[model samples]
Target: MRLPKTAHTSRPWRIHEIAGDFQVEDVWALPTPGGPDDLAHLVDQFAQGKGEPIDSPVARALFAIRWKLGALFGWDKPDGGVGGRLTSLRGRLPADLREGPKGPDLTAAPFTSVFQTHDEWAAEMGNRTVHGVMHIGWVPDGAGGYRGQMAVLVKPNGRLGALYMLGIKPFRYLGVYPALIREIGSEWRARAGQRAAGSAGAAGAGG
Candidate 1:
């Protein structure tokens, strides 16, 4: 579900310290409720690319079109990415964060891990249009369980970048995000079922 910017800003997230100059583009409440310690599992799912909405045809098509456009326009050239166009957020990490788990490399997305902790994970990606961070946090759901929260922060390249973000805002909100929410919810439930089945099998064997 779409959340107010405060949902992200109100938290004392490390991303606030790292990406202070970036704009908060979107905040979302992910439907992946579980135990407090489940954040690691959630992060692992993302690392494996299972957290993405790849099964959604609409999302798949949009992604294909965007990549095609990017390729045609030289928007995704290596020089326009992380270590070239923009300095990596990894360089700004404090010593503790630098030494901590940096999460796993994402095979599904072009993002690179910045840092990871017990409850938070951050990754960064950049292109000609923007330098962006994907910040994921495990937060209390108010119903006694924990769920995931995501915030996207971006630093646009300039006038052209700003225009590009503006142009895609509608599609992101209307088409992409809804598909993502559904896919995440479905994946979360499937994982829960698998865990439950595993527990049952263990109990049966012990009996």
Candidate 2:
């Protein structure tokens, strides 16, 4: 579900340290609820591309259209991406965070991991339109369990980038994000079911 920007800003996330100049474009409550240690599993799912909602036809079509547009316009040229037109956020990391696990290389997205901690993981990507950060945190649900929260932060390139973000806002809210939430929930449930089945089989073997 879409959340207020405070849902991300209010937290003590390490992302705040490095991405202060970027604006918070969106915040979402992810559906992957679990115990404290489960953030790693959630991050793994993302890195493996198992939880991306782009598999949904609508989301896939939208992404394909976006990529085609980018290709035609030179928006995604290598020179426009991170480490080219934009400096990587990794360069801004503090000493401790820089030395920590940089998380896994994502198979689904162009984002490169910046840092990872027990409860937070951050990755970044850039193009002609913007330099963006995807920050995920495991937060207490107030009901004892913990769930994932995602925040998107961006520094737009200029007028073109601002207009592009404005143009896509409707489609993102109406189609992409909803499908993303549903897919993540479905994948999380499937993983839970597999774990349960494995435990049951182990119990049966012991019996």
lDDT (C-alpha, whole model) for all candidates: 0.88, 0.90
Residue runs of model 2 more than 4 Å from their true location after superposition: 50-52, 193-207
Q: For each predicted model, how many residue pairs clash, with residues at least 3 apart or on different chains?
A: 0, 0
Error of 1 at 90 (Å): 0.6
Model 2 clash pairs are none
- What lDDT is obtained when candidate 1 is compared to the true structure? 0.88
What tens-digit string does per-residue lDDT give for candidate 1 at 124-191?
A: 99999999999999999999999999899999999978999999899898778888777777778878
Candidate 2 lDDT over 126-188, as tens digits, reads 999999999999999889999999999999999999999999999899879899888888888
Which predicted model would earn the best lDDT?
Answer: 2
- When superposed on Cα atoms, how far off is each prediction in RMSD? 2.9, 3.2
Worst 10 residues of 2 by lDDT: 48-57
Candidate 1, which segments miss by more than 4 Å at Cα? Answer: 50-52, 193-207
